[model samples]
Target: MAVDDFNRADSNDLGVNWTESDYSTPNSLRILNNRLRMGEANGIAHYNGTFADDQYVEATVTGMQFGDGQTGIAVRVSGSQGGFSAYAAILWPVSGRVRLYKYVSAWIVADAQVELANVPYTLLTDGVLQFSTVKIAAIGATIKVYIDSVEVISVSDNSIASGNPGLIARSSYWVELDDWTGQSLSYDITADAVTNGSITPAGVTSVVGGGSQMYAITPDSGYGIFDVLIDSVSVGAVSSYNFTNVAEAHTISATFGPLMGQRALLKIRPENCGHITINDNSPQYWFQHGDNIVIEPVPDAVYALKLYVSDFPDAALTTGEPDSLPDEFHSCIVDFACYALSMKLKKWKQAAKYYNIYVKNLTQRRKDYIDRKAEKRAIHQIPNNIKYGGTRQ
Candidate 1:
């Protein structure tokens, strides 16, 4: 069994081995709506069991208010009466970001943070409630994070490898959790490459059933895929393999041999600029497409002659271009630029048409992006049949 759902009225009963932290206040944490809800006090509800090193823990939290509050999941927790420690992946509504923290001595320590999309997330009420699905996957020293089914962060840390699993919340927030699940995988999968080749999804071993594990074989320069093996059995020399609905443990290995003869290397000269200038008023030195470059600066006689320039590449307009605007709406760049140009030329009708096109494109792109993200979430559903054990049970 790989999943657990707290959907019963007595879900909080100790008989199920669900225990609150010694620091949590009585009645501050309870089961409601078949989900765990936390009240005003900062608290942690721990499942009293020891899980393996490679495991995944996740929960869906809702009814979170936007203030100095956070709610999330804790894994690999270890400590005693005076001090307890664990790694927490939290949804911080106030900051509009998801953060990973290492908690020790009752203090939360920041590890990593990523900003959330500005789109209006699914909300039950008008600006009063927001929900998020937070998941943490730990395999050996590598830790991967996912929010609402989107993979956000992947880090490596081996400080705390194995311990108990639980939930965490800060003060003055009412947070509800559902589909809280933890699984202890049975088998370990590993991979090794010889002669300048690499494999991915290699380090991960505790994948649950119905989960798809993709293995990508990448060879270094001057090498080609020679052979691929699964559990020492030949699986041909394919560049990639997908193990869908993985239900058993297996070992994968790839080997790379030399490419035919010697391959010529190609190189290109760097771009050269005629001159450079320094502008303190500008937020950044790198200019993007259509960005206005200002030449005027307040005169300071002593520093006027000094010039400092940095080599910055011009931003490109492409499918994979990185920009402040969402990637899906990158196609509207032309419409937006045309709208601005029309306004400058005092062409009211042309400006309005371009503006409307830009708005419509942006709105439709946002909807499409949201829909694609929703599909990604459905692909990684948490496994079922998780068990929590304690002395009371």
Candidate 2:
């Protein structure tokens, strides 16, 4: 990384570290009042050092006053001062436009090989003088432009692959550039996970050259983290991992296994009662060794069991037998049954009285069912990606 705050004695010569566009015109670009000021209408200057192929250049540009031209930062600058090939992130104050360009020979628009991307930007406030930090990054085949810490343009082009970092003032010389910084960019870190587990940020993620990234591993229900692998090497059963000062591409994966304590325990008995039908299918059941029973079909994996039945029982329950319906809904069933009994006895007046009571009870029961289902939908809703299927409640 290289940084220059331009805190130097006021001089027409920009020192040995910089290469100016015009060597004959010394005063066109100079350091004044600790700031690098571009006095000429279309002056360009670049640092002498060449950074990595994937690098960035950033500087704080202060517009001394409103101007009609553009000022920008450039990356991957190659060739001499006149025939330089580079990518630039430019800001136009008058039109509030930020543009990314690929230049081949000069700062003129006709000299640009391609207009990569552009976005609107507000460079100044109504009254206050505005200072915006401009950044231009060229990593691999991609180029990203940022103004005031906000990304304005990102495009992929492999035109120019290497060069030095620099500053540009195309007819916008009334600007002071400071806090210039240039550094190599970071690489992408791709993460993945298999069934029964997940890795946070489970996709391609970029990390700064000397920055850190932390990832959390979580296992699904009835499962435990079995192993974690970083760059295809086992890292044990870690719940989380951190990458410090990431400088290259990396890959991570996680695996899970069934939790032994939560495994499905089968304890079946002889089938004394009749078979139950589910969705019009009757699964066979039989007695096994010594009072042990096994059902014909069951899910191989751990899953929730949900049973849905008619609102009312098909037959009357025996004395002391519990009803499947909740206690509150039991009265409505009894009222409807009484109405049916009165009609069977050929008592018209009594049947009408019982039917009226049953209708009122049925209305209230229907309302209660709606309210109960709504409550379950709100509190016990399941995500679409869950492994097992079940009712809301």
Best by lDDT: 2
lDDT (10s digit) by residue, model 2, range 1-393: 778888989987778887767523444576888887666546567788746677899988854457756567788876655677788877766667788888776544445546788787777677354556889988778899877777778899988877888776666435567899988787788888879979998898887665678999888865666678999998866778999767579999998766533322123221121122223344522223123222222212222222222133232223442335556656766765565444333234564566456444544554455356633211111111112211111
Q: Compute each candidate's TM-score over C-alphas.
A: 0.44, 0.49
lDDT of 1 at 245: 52
List the pairs of residues colliding in candidate 1: 2-384, 3-384, 3-385, 3-386
Task: Kindly report which residue stretches of model 1 are placed more than 4 angstroms away from their true locations once superposed.
Answer: 1-4, 10-15, 105-132, 185-393
lDDT tens string, model 1, 1-393? 234566676434423566666444454466767777665456666677666656678887656665646677877666742466667776656556666666655543223223222222233345554446778766666666787777777777766767667777666655567888876545556877755879986575666543667788887765656678888998766678777655468788988765434221111111211111232333333433233233321211111111111122432212532225555556766766675454333234575577556545544554455456533211110111111111001
lDDT of every predicted structure (CA atoms) = 0.55, 0.62
Best of the candidates, TM-score: 2
